[model samples]
Every structure is written in C-alpha cells, then in structure tokens.
Target chain A: MTIQRRAAFGVAAALPFAGARGQAAQTIRIGVLNDQSGPYRDISGPSGVQCALQAVAEFGSRGFNVEVINADHQNRPDVGVNIARQWYDQGVDMIIDVPTSSVGLAVNNVAREKNKAYINTGSATSDLTGAQCSPNTIHWMYDTYMLAKSTGAAMVRAGGDTWFFITADYAFGHALERDTGNFVRGAGGRVLGSVRYPFPATTDFSSFLVQAQASRAKVIGFANAGADTINSIKQAAEFGVTRRGTKLAALLMFLPDVHSIGLETAQGLVLTESFYWDLNARTRAFTDRMRPRLRDVVPNMASAANYSATLHYLKAIADMGVAASKASGIDVINRMKAMPCDDDAFGAGTIRLDGRKLCPAYLFEVKAPAESRGRWDYYKLVQTTPAEEAFRPIGEGGCALVRS
Target chain B: MDLFGIPAPLLFGQVLLGLINGAFYALLSLGLAVIFGMLNVINFTHGAQFMMGAFVAWMLLEWLGIGYWGALLLAPLIVGATGIIMERLMIARLYKLDHLYGLLLTFGLGLIIEGLFRNEFGSSGLPYRIPVELQGAWDLDFMFMPVYRGWVVLVAFVMCLATWLVIEKTKIGSYLRAATENPALVQAFGINVPRMMTLTYGAGVALAAFAGVLAAPIYSVNPQMGSNLIIIVFAVVVIGGMGSILGSVLTGFGLGIIEGLTKVFYPEASSTVIFVVMALVLLARPAALLGRS
Candidate 1:
C-alpha cells in the first residue's frame, strides 16, 4: 500500500513538469512584473500588462502561442527576485516593465542566472547599463542620463542656473540626483544643496522643502517620481516656493503624475519623458489603439515602452529561429541589439551596445491652467534632444560590454 | 547662531514642522490608545479606516460636489458607522481570544480593505485641493507657514484636548473608565459595557477618519498613505504607553518633534529614530511610558 501511494504521488508531481515541457517550445510567455499596487501603479502597473498584450496583438505572434502574465512585486527586491526566478524557471521567456530601481536590479540578476530576456521599461537607474548591465537585460525606456539632460540641463541652459534637490533616499533617487547634479555643474550651474529624505515613507516633506527654499536656489529639482513627486510638488505650491519665481524642475515626471496633480498646481512645471501620446500622429495612432485596451487611462512613456520593447522582442524572435532564441538569452538580446528598432509608439530608435535604447527625449513644459486644452493634454513641448545624444555616451557608461 | 551645523532659523523651521507632524501623531495615537484601553485589542484596521475617510472625502467632492468643509464632518461619520458595523460583526467575536488572534484578523482585514481601494482608485493617489479659505502662507520670521498647515495644528490640538476631556472629565467618561476596569461590575450596574466598548471602537475609528480628512489636502489620498503613516503612529502609540490616553497624546507630539529634528541632523535616521525610541522604551519600561503595571 505504501509503495502504491508513493508511486501515485511521484506521478502527480512529475505531471506538471511534463506538461510544462511539452508547452515550452511552442509558447512565448512574457511576464510583466511591476509595482501593481505600490506608488508606481499609476505610472505603470496593470496598464503595463495591457501594453504587453497590445504588443502581442500588434506583432500577431507569427507562429508561436504568446501569453502575457503579470504579478505585483510590491516594490521589494526579495519579492521581485522570487517572482522573476519563478517565472523564468517555469518557461517564461522574458520579464518586462519593472518601475522600482532596487527591484529592477534584483530581477536583472535573476534573469542573467536563469538565461531569460529582461527588457526593462520602467526603472530609471543608469546602473542597469553601467556597472550592473547584464547580457540578458535591455534598458528600454528613459534613464537618469536622458532625464537629467532634457530637464536638468535644459533648465540650466535656460538660466535657472542654481539648483537645489529634494531627493528620495533610494537607488533611483540617488542615481537621478547624481546624474542631474553632474549635468547642472557641467553646464556652469552651481549646486546649492540637496536634502535626501527617507523613501517609501516620510511623506511629509515640509522640512525638506523649507531647507531647499532657504538655500535660495534658482530651481528646485525634484529627483523622485510617482506619489513622492506628486506630494512634493503639491506641498511646494502650498509653501509658495513656486510663487517667488523659483522654477520647479520635475526631473522625471510621468504622465499620470501630472494627471493626478491637476492643471492649477502642475502648471509651469518642466519635466522630461521619452513618450507622449499627443506627440505626433504615430503616437496618437498608438494611443487610439491602446485606448480601448487600457480603459480610460492615458498611456505614458512607461506603458509605451512596454509596448515598444515587447513588439521589438517578438520581432527579434521572428528574425531569429525560435529554438536558437530559447536556447540562449544573450543571443536573442544581441539580435535585438543588432536590429534597428522601429515602432509606432517610440518611432525610429536604436539599441546601443551598452543595452540602452537610444531615443529622442522631449523637454515638456506643463501648460498653464489658462493655456490648457482639455483632459490628458498637459504638456507643451519645449525642446527635443535627438536620439543620438538622448542617452549617455557609451564610453562614459563604464559598461563592460561596451568597453570591450 | 548655529547648533550642530544647522542654522538657527532652519532649526526653528524644523521644530515648527515637527509640531505640525506631531499634531497628526497625537490625534492618531489618541484614538489607538482609547481603543486599546477599552477593547484590549490592537486596532490594525485604523489605517484602512483612515484611508477610507480620505476616499470618502474624495468621493463626496467628485460624486456629490461637496467641498472640503462638508467632507470634514461627513467622512468621519460615514467611516465611523462602518467601524461600528465591523466591530459588531467581526471584532466583537474575538474579545475572548488571544491578542494574536485579534491582530491577525484586523491585519488581514486592513489588507483586504486597502486592496479593494487600490483596485478601485489605483495607487497613484487622487488629488484633493486645499480648502479655499486656508490657501495662502504666513511669512514667519523663520519660514513660510501655509495657513492650512497652521490651521491643521490648531484644530488637531483642540480636537485632541476635546477628546481627552470627554474621556477624562464627564460622567460618560467615568463610566467608560469604570467599564474598562471592571466590565462585569459596570454591566451589572446597568451601564451596558458591551455597547460602550462598541461605541469606543467607533469613536476611535472616527478619530482616525478625522485625521484622514485633515491629511487629504496635504498628503496623497492613496491607499498606501495610511499604511505608511500607520507604522510610525503605532511606534508613537507604543512609545506613548499603549492604552494611556494622556501618554499617547504627549508622546505623539514629542516623537514628531524628535523625528523632525532628526531630519535636520541626520535625515538618514529620521524614519528609524522613532523605532529606535520604541525599542529603548520597550526595554526600559515594558509597560510603556504611562501604561499601568
């Protein structure tokens, strides 16, 4: 009786692996791991999965059966690492669209170990392509370098020369503050001072704001994103720091952030994002396609990058044989890097040697309340940094892949 | 004059900022202390209820066009009624169980409520405009004090005082104190101790909701907002002498000031300062600063 019972349990355990083995070859599972309920949910969460699904539809999957699955990492590195390992081990070919930087770096390690593609769209840390760049990962969306150049450098050039930063105390915030400070000082602007507040908590930024104001900087650069960015901006207005002609530079503002801030408060704030739905006809067409899928949510750069990255990944799969692509993640990443990236969402762009996606970064000035048009129309384009200069120079990135 | 490398004016500004934050801590911990004193159960749902208060205020504005003034009154009442129902159906059953059971149930309930709100609104946090009457700033000698912030501190102090009075002075307050000490005796005396416990729970939840309404204008009215603040407030309650009314109020403000000063001296340790204090307080006095033996 014991032998029979043990045999039955053994068979039951092996059944799932057998089923997984049969489906692994013909299936392409893209796992969308992101901050589904944390601070980044608005910027990119459930909508990111929708963009991935939209990518599958637009690409048409060719011959393989494509499935998109998503899970919330809760913005923790351990949680993200576990999900990434589980997904990769269970036949997931790629994991895409993680917003939080710590989680992004953690999952980047997991993907390299498991030999699965990681097309990052949401994280802003430049370390993904610098010291921590993995052969399995592609840094797809806007990074700290692009944002600091577009918003930070642009503001400095426009005569907001002196800057103070209210930086979130985390990997993402530290990277942004560092990159922007470098650009600010590089552009002959003086760095007044900065306050690094605790992250994921410490919502009351009154003391930090007061400190920045007292620094008497020409511009207050907010080196944080999501709800932290929204709160600081809203509170800064309440403190009337903006009223005294100190320009507020939102170094990394997502579309949903401006949406949440409303026009009256968000007006006159300058920010940088790689994708805007209202930028051009192609972007508009892409938005129209995604509108029905996303359900009343405006598709921001994060969402657009998910769509662009997924489509390009699928296209690379179509170019290279499925067996070869599945056999090595590095090969697939190299193929993706080899191909010129063209999509309706981001237009024409190229994947650099350092695994960074090179695309034009737009400097957008938030329209004044009176100058606003309608809903979701928050930005008026100020200037555009071209695709070639939009990202960091490969030599300066300290990426081993690029250096060799 | 400068102390510890920070200028005096900035130090004064940080102190004032600390007081404003203390106002929130005082109000939140007062409710927590009251509930723990009467019910002997940890109120983990307080954070979710606070979040509900903010969401209700947003709903009243978006759905019914009610302004901030209207929401200040209605949000608490509505959330308090829900708390009463929650106490009756769920929390009341666990009165005879261990503290662990009460904690597990309420923590699970808090997660569910926060999840439901996140599902509906998403975690990006909705915007609530500052009230028109309290919009401008007062250029103080040290800093620019937003009128709304000052009003928040004033009203929070008054409300904390009022809550303290009702529980410490009145005949109803005496009955509440008596019921907590000897519920069976109080019930035998025709005091209806069970009803009082239920009402105390409701009132404590209402206090959290009131704080939420006050916070809606300043902070992000998102589901995670309460959870983020709740941990610190719990630390405040623990340091204040859990279940001690006056202790919770005083420690709430005191810790806020300490945390504020920490932000200036070493902002890296700002979030950790309260927890460190909590650990020290627990080690030195397990009963808490004002908690009875």
Candidate 2:
C-alpha cells in the first residue's frame, strides 16, 4: 500500500477508537500533566498549562492542531501514573512536564511501558538519564548530579573547601548528598560532617545549624529545597555561623527562596543552576515574555524547562504527522526522538534517544551587600559550568542506556 | 571504628542534634497542645501564625530597628493581639459547632495568610541574625555546640514547662479549665466565659508566635515556612493525642530524639521512622503513645 493510502486507512480505522466521539481526530491531543493543586502546586500549576498553550500556539502554524489538558498529580506517583494512563488511553499524543521527580519518573515508566512520549521537565533525578533512563523519557532540566557537581566541585576548587551538609531527609536529599560528596572528595576537599532534618521539618533548624556551626566547615551546603533550605540558612545566620566566616552554598535554591530570604541574608551565597533570570540577553527576553504569565514567581529553571519541552513535544507530533496518521504511542515517541529542539532555556539541544537532554549550567554568586543596588538584585554570574562536564559521568550513573 | 567501638564524637554529636530537634518539636507541639486545650480547636493556622511571628520579628528589625530582644517580646504580643481579634470575631462562633469547622476555618485563614505573605515577600527566606552576644560556639570535649542553638533549646524547654505549669497549676488556669468544661456553670459563678475563651485562644496563639520568634533566628523567615512544618506538627499532634498538654510536649521531644537516633543507626528510615512509629503506636493503642482515650 502507498504511504498516503496506508496513512488514510490508519486514521479511518483509528477514528472510532479515539477518545473524542464525532469530533475530528485531526487535532493533536497533548497532556500537560503536572502537580497543579497540591504540595507542588505553586511550583508547576497553571503556569505549566500556560506553557503548554504557548507551545501549541507556536507549533500550530507549522502543520499541527494542538489540544492541551492540564491535571494536578498531587505529587503522588500513583496519581501521575494514572493521569498518564488516562491521557494515553484517551489518545493523548504525548505527556509533558511532570514535575515531582518521583511522579515524573513514575510517569516515564508508564509512558515507556505504554509506548508513549514522556517529556519530563519537573523531575531532577539523574536516574531519568541513567539506570532508570527510558527510551521514551527526556529529563530536560537540572538533576541532582548536575546541580551538585556544578556547585560543589567548582566551589570547593575555588577555596570554599571543608563542607557541612544540612540536608532534607528524603530520597532527593540522599541523592544530592551522595553526588555532592562525590564532587567534594573528587575536588580534594574533605566533608566535615552532615545532618539530616526531616522533610517538612518545623520552623526551628537551630539544632542543624548548631551542628553545621560545630563542624566549622568553610561551606555549609544545604542539600534541601523549598522552605527547608530557607529555614536552615536563616537559622545558620541567627546562630551567627555565617558571620563567623562559615559560607553557605545552597545546592538547589530557587529564585523564590532568594526572594523570601531577602537580599541581606541571601547575599554572598554561591550556588549553581541551569538557568537564571538575568543571565544573558536571551534569558532576559524569555523572562520578559514569561513575566506577565508567571505573575510573582520569576521563571525558574523548572518553568523554562516546561515551556521548552512542551514546545518540542508538539513540534515532534506535527513533524511525524502523528495526529493525521492517528499513530499509536511508540510511533509518536520515535518521531519526537528524530526532531531537534532549539529553545530559550538551553539555546539549542537535541533529545538523546536514551532520554538525556544535555544543557549548560551556571555557577552564581549571591551578590554581596555592597554589590546589590536594590531588591531582586541578588545574584551575579560567577562562571558557567561547561555542558560537557556539568552532569554526572555517564558510566558512573548506572543508566542502562549508557553503553560500557 | 575510631576510639570506642562506636565513634564517641559521632554518638555525642547525634545525641546533641537529637536534643536540639527535640527542643523545636517540644516548642511547636506544645503550642499546638495549648491551642487545642482551651479553644477545643485544632488551629490549623498555628504554623502560619508561627511563620507570621518570624516575619513580624524580621520586619520589626528591618523596618523599625527593633532588635532581636525587642522582637522577642513584641512580636508574640502583636501576634497574640491579632489572635484575640480572630477569636472574638470568627473562632467564637464555632465554639458550639463541630471541631472540624474550627479546623477548616483556621485552615482557610492559613491559606490567606500564606498567600498574602507570599505575595508580599516572595518565597525566599529573610535572615534574622543572632545577637552578637550569642554568636560563638561552645566547645565540649565531644561535640561543639553553638551558643545560640543551646539557648534556643533551653529557652524552648523552659517555655514549654512554663506553659504546662500555668495551665495545670495556676488560679487563672483553674478558671480557664472550668470554663472549658462547663461554660454555663463557670459564667454563673461570675467568671466571664466568653472573655476566658477569647483569652485562651489568644494565649494559645501567642505560644505559637513565641515558637516562631524562637525559630526566626534559626530558620530563614519565609511565607511557606509554616506550611511545611505544619503538616509534620499535625502528624506529631496525631501521634501525641491533642488532649493532654504534657503528653504532647513529651511525645514531641521523644519522637524528635527517636528520629535523630534513627539517622545514626539506619539512615534510610530516619525520615519515615516517625510515621512508622506512629503507625505502630496506632496499631498497638489507637489513642497514641500518650493520648487520652
């Protein structure tokens, strides 16, 4: 049969099977699945949906009719898996931007098993590109290894040696600690000691701060995020640990954390990230476009990843003529693998079939009290971690996709 | 592997860390218990109130030049006064209703407070410096402790004990308890029950704010600060029965110590061990380790 004839036949046969009854199957159905209304709500809710819409608008003119569906996974692996399943079962071409790493990884498993494309933007586990790496998943943003390696090794080499970790006690924290420890040891620095505070630990980090102070480590690395990172740093200051010449290195701080801690406390802290608001002219332009959309929360790496990944997913669907051909999950995914994604976050990056999306990361120094002219005037670019050496060594990651 | 069969420094340090976490848990759970005792209401907003206290203190220092000492006394009073207004206006009506309504109302209040704070200050924490006097670390042979952290633990413990004493031993506490048990009788006996209820809520909320002030120096002051800790406190309250003041305090401190020890022995289970213990406790006796049946 001719390609055109076969494609027409496939659509005719798949029409009755599509989720939308009587509606034309010409529109590309993409699921912008994320944690919308739970713990991760503020991080990846309506803004994620808007990101998907922007992608659809940008990719629509290039021969794709896009439809986006947003859902709150509530940080539950089961919920995220179910959402992906439902979207796939209901004829969604791809699932994009599942944020919580556990949930994102779970969705990737479902997508791979079901033969659908899962464009991961929210998760930060290196496993998505390593042992747990799936042919069907793409970890588009920062991972623990990338974050730790960039900040830990570089900072230690720059004389911020002797480390104390104030870690959030969980899988993420463990991963961060392990990766950062590797970086520190590799950089000829000694890890003094560490303390693990429970997840959602109450307001007092006095004890952890005390432990960090007692270590007298030059750098107190906070391998935590959200309020936990904020609190630990705050308490460290209160105990005068920082003033006593102990510098802080927040391994995974978001812009929101900087804003919350205010300029005074957040100043002079060196950290690393894949993206920053005022990094370059391109980034500034991107943030300018995303500002009205994000409202208060500045476009962090996660949001940027979401925007870029969603755009790339739609472009892949259009390129393969998946919607018109009524292609199954694996067909759509294979097509996505063939396309190159060039976006504002990573400039120009290709999706590796093994799911490792390579990107450059930057080391940022929180501006000193004197350096800051005003509020939001927080970080100054110190150095950029070259993309090649920014992430975990492929062989060491244990990702099945990497060949020995 | 070093000196003793176990590393003495490691053991000592872990113990110190345990004591420190225990102090925070005791202070937070103690505040929760006080709120529950008199208001008969689980102030879901307690964590938010705590966050507010820290923010208020930070603001006092930043905007008004009110130092740590001034904020320590003034911040809680400001929060307490707000609580009084909240008690008189909204919480007073729900006294006769199911406790769940109070929880829901307080939860709504928490959302509002968190949203406002997030909008105003953003999510990053504002650092509150420790006073110069408490800046240094004290060396013990085994493990060095920061002077400020040691002070936090001591002060929180004292505060917890004082609150327990005031509620369990004082004349005002006696009248407060009577009003809680039999409002009509207490009113007939010339004690204004409404005023007592309002004051109780005010006091209960004040404790939460007090904990906040104590925490401000340790944790960066942020909007979502209370939300994160609040859930854990809820779990703490559930594990410790909200009924008895002493039970809550003991359970809070005890669980924190257990959690710290778990980190040393079995690192993986450290985060989840508390919940696991809570589950086991629930299975053995549903009223919690120290909860009243």
Candidate 3:
C-alpha cells in the first residue's frame, strides 16, 4: 500500500501516529505563506491562502492527509524567511504561494539551505530560476523574460516596429525595460526613445507621451504596473497618443487592473500571461468549484497555483513513510521532489529537483466592445506559448541545480 | 557630457521638473500641517479626503456633464462640506482626549473610505481627462514643458502662500490661533470656539480637496491613491517637524527637489533617500529643519 493511503487511513482512524512524528498520521501539515498585508497584499493575500485549504479538501479524498497554517509576511524579506524557517522547524514539508519578489527570493535561499520545498506562486523576478536558482525553490508564476519574449518579441514580429518605453524608475522596471529592449532589437525593430517616471509619481504622462509622440514609436511600452499602468494608459488616451497610431503594451497586468481600465482603453492591447481565469477545462473547473466556497468571486491564477502546489506536497509526504527522522522537513521535501504532479491547475506538471516547475504560458489580447462578452470576459487567447518555449531556456538560465 | 550646445539647458530643465514635483509635495504637506496645527490632531484620513476630491470631480464630469472647469470649482466645496459633517459628528467627541484617539479614528475612517472605493473600483485608477485648454506644451528653447504641468506648479505655490497669509495675518486667523492655544479663554470671549475649531478643520481639509482637484488631471483617480501618497507625506511632515505652517511648505518642496536630484544621480536610493535625510536631520537638530525646538 502507498504511504499516502496509510497516512489517510491512520488520520481517519484517530490513531496517535497521526500527530506524532514517525507514527502513522493521517493528516499532512502544509504551510501557506504569502503577503497578507503590505504593498503586495492586493496581489495575493487571504484569498490565495483560502485556495490552499480548498485544495486540501479536494485532494484529501484521494488518500490525502492535510493541515494548513498561514502567515502574513507584510512583504518583508526577513519576515518571510523567519516564517519559512519556523514552518520547517515545526515539520512542515512544503511552503506555498510566496508573493513579493525580494521576499520570495530570500525565502528561496533559506528553503534550499534547509532542503524544504518552496513553491513560489506569486513572485516575478527571473533571478530565482537563473543565477540565484535553488534545488528547493520553484518559481511557479510569470517573470520579466517571459513577458518580454511573449509580448515584446511577438508584438514586434506582428508589425509593432518602432518602440519606446515609459518606465517606472526602479529596479524591477529597469530589468523589464532592458529585456524588452533586447527583444525589440532582436526583432529588427528600431529603438526610438524612452522616459523614466519616478515611482508612485502622479499620472502626469504628458511629457513622457510627448517624448514618445516625437519619437513616433509604433508601440509605447509601459514597463510599469498597478496604478502606474492605469494612469499611463488613461493619460495616453487623453493625449490622443493611441489615436495617433501608437499602441500601448502593458508588460505586466492583472484581472483587477483590467476591470479598472475598462474595455475602451484596454481593447486590442496584447500581453502575455501564465494563466487566465477562463483559459481551459481545468482552469474553469477549479474556478467553478472555488466560487461557491469563495463566495462567488472568480479564482485568479495565484489562487489556482497555490491549490496545485499544496496538494502535490501532501501527496508526496504520505508517499514517504512517517519515520521519526523521515518526518524532519528535509527528508519529507526530498520525497516530494521525487514525485510527478497531475492536478486540476496544471495537469501533469512536474516539480523538478532544482525547483523550476513547468507550466504553459498564454498570450492574450484584450477584447473589444464589439465582442459583447460579459464582465471578466476581457481577454481572448491569441496563442499558447508551449511550456518549453514560454520560459527562459534551461541551458541559458545557468542554474547550478540543472546539472545536478 | 554636453549635447546640442545645451548642458545648462538640460540641468535647468531637470531643475524645473524638480520644482514642479516640489510644488505638489509642498501643497500636500502643507495641508497635513494645517490639519495637525488647528485640531492638535493628525488626520490620517487626509489622503482619503484628497482622493474623494478627485473622485467627486470625476463623477461630476462623467455623470452630470459638469466639465473640468466646473469640477475644479465645485469639487473642493463638496468634499469640504463632507469634512464639516465628519468633524461635527466624529472628531468633536475626541477633543480633551489623547490626541491619538483622533488619529486612530481618522485612520479607521481612511480604511473605510479606501475599502468602499476598492470594492467599487478595484486597485487601478480611473483616468480623468485634462481640460482642452491645458493640452499643449510650451517650448522655451531649452525644454518642452506641458502647459498643465506648469500651471500645477504655479497654482500650488499660490495656494500654499495664500493659506499661510490667511492663517498668519487675518483677524479670523488670530482667533483660530488663540483658540488653539487657549480654547477656554477664546470661548469665554464669545467666539464660538467649538464652531471655529470645526471650521478650521473643514478649511484645512478643503485645501487637500483643492490639491486633489488639481491632481485629477495628472494622476489616475483611484481608491489606493491617497493611502500610497499619504505615507510619504507623513514622512515629509515628520521631517518638517509639523512646527510652523511655512516650515512644512518649505521642507516639502526642498525634500521633493532633493528626491528629484537623487533620481537624476543614483536613482535606486530615490525612494528611501527622503527617510534617510529625515534621519540625518533628526540627528543634527532632532526637531527638523523648520520645526520648533
């Protein structure tokens, strides 16, 4: 019999082994750690945490054993690191849904050092699976290189020749601009001009828009997100920049952002995404099941990713028998890493030992008013970038774990 | 380092952009300072009031065909009127209590306002159109500055000065200051001190609303807008020592320009550099540059 089935039966029978180390415990303890309150709070928070709980129940029937503990890091690197370390100390085999990039990076290092599996479902930095890659840390969501390749290169090839950037003046924005610049150049496109707006600066994109207008770039790339993107796009409309035939490409966006910008401004804009709410049968099924429990708000990609990672972690722990030493975090994590995942979110995805999980990326275009779709029907699939082609090539990432 | 025979011009243009940002910081910090001074209370809700001003202006235009000119005139009045009601019902009860009570109350109010708006509009900002009159750029041989941006700096400066002049020079201002120092004595003088205090708060909030109206053209009007900007303003206020009215204004503009220069040079330290400067200033004077000892 599989260890998962044993753990399941042990938990159901109310045996002492369920809670005791090495004893047959039916329940598996999984940690859901992410920013609950901070700058990144709205991006992923209690909603994602709750999604893991829903996953625990869904996967529980398949000889699954589960318990979930949540913590809010407030976007502090140290806070996230501490939460992760303590969870491992308490025999947590896996941690899921870490959001903030800097914080997520910090947690990745600690997870590798401790040998506890870390599933980063929310962070956007490419360094995680590249130079800073770890055997235990898996960056499950989108990154700048993917965004650049999928949006910038694809758009240029499809006839967005001249390019200009209106970037948020910061590290993240700078990285995005650099990647997109390379993609534009590689596509034989002309680099027209660019402007850097101070972070959190009010929306006045007039000077920036005027600069882009003067450059006559066919596409004015906005290397910013959140309020910055909303303001730049809106002001671009006000200045008639879009009407002047300059398309705006938002490098990163979320469903909430689309709702705020509305159809008039967002229509015909092409962007890349790892997941969309209504993308496939699996995605629709997950959202439909989560809606009743979640009080009817559609499940976003972050929440879905959290559910998939948490369930897979539990299955792995049950597969590995509860020997006292085996109950130690590193031992359990190693066991999970050896398994293949087949779930609702990413059906048949694998969690590699080096922690670079694989998933397909989708290129989506914002729908126009004539589409006459309901709310949240904002995006129509343009193309699906296969999992292998969607990300930075493994050979080029230079990750130490790729060799081992 | 020179391009197009315009080294000085480039420096001058960057300086002008710095000054433009300074004007905004000055106006926002000035509003925070005024609200703190009159009520002996830190209004954490000031940012929400500012956001409310912009949203009110947008709703008026989008729903009622009020137009930009009309919103510029009416939005502040509408928001200030709401401020008066809030002050009477909620803030009035907190006087003679620890000042933190008012701060906490305002913070709660800020959350409620921001939450309600977030529920309706989400985190992204709704764009407001700049008036047609303010559309073009002014080419001055050195830099092409947007006309609306130039106007924002000009009007913000005038508004800050007018606020200082009214509070420091007028008869009503003297009564307000007197009440701040000794409300019991001022009330004994048959001045309706409570009413005066309430109006003082309303007016201070009105200034924030006015700044919001000006901001709607430049920034997206969003629920989180006020919360994001307010934290920095708090840091600005702390650095200014909230000492005197003029002190907050000057410190705000000075620090904004300093931040802008940081952007031109290092760029990475631009955001946290203000707080770093605040720490150094605190170490040197402990009471801020323009603050009282």
Which is the leading candidate under DockQ? 1
Residue pairs with clashing backbones, model 3: A4-A318, A11-A26, A17-A24, A18-A25, A22-A322, A28-A65, A203-B219
Writing each residue's lDDT as its tens digit, candidate 1 over A68-117 gives 77887889999889777867776678899988999999999999998889
Candidate 2 docking DockQ: 0.30
Name the candidate that leads on lDDT: 1
lDDT of 3 at B236: 83
lDDT digits (tens) for residues B117-202 of candidate 1:
98888888888999999999998867899999999999999998998899899999999999888898998998888899999999
Comparing 2 and 3 on DockQ, the stronger one: 2
lDDT of 2 at A159: 91
Best by TM-score: 1
Worst 10 residues of 3 chain B by lDDT: B1-10
- Scored by CA lDDT, what does every candidate get? 0.89, 0.74, 0.75
The TM-score obtained by model 1 is 0.96
**lDDT preference between candidates 1 and 3, better one:** 1
List TM-score per model, in order: 0.96, 0.81, 0.81
Model 1: per-residue Cα lDDT at residue B167: 89
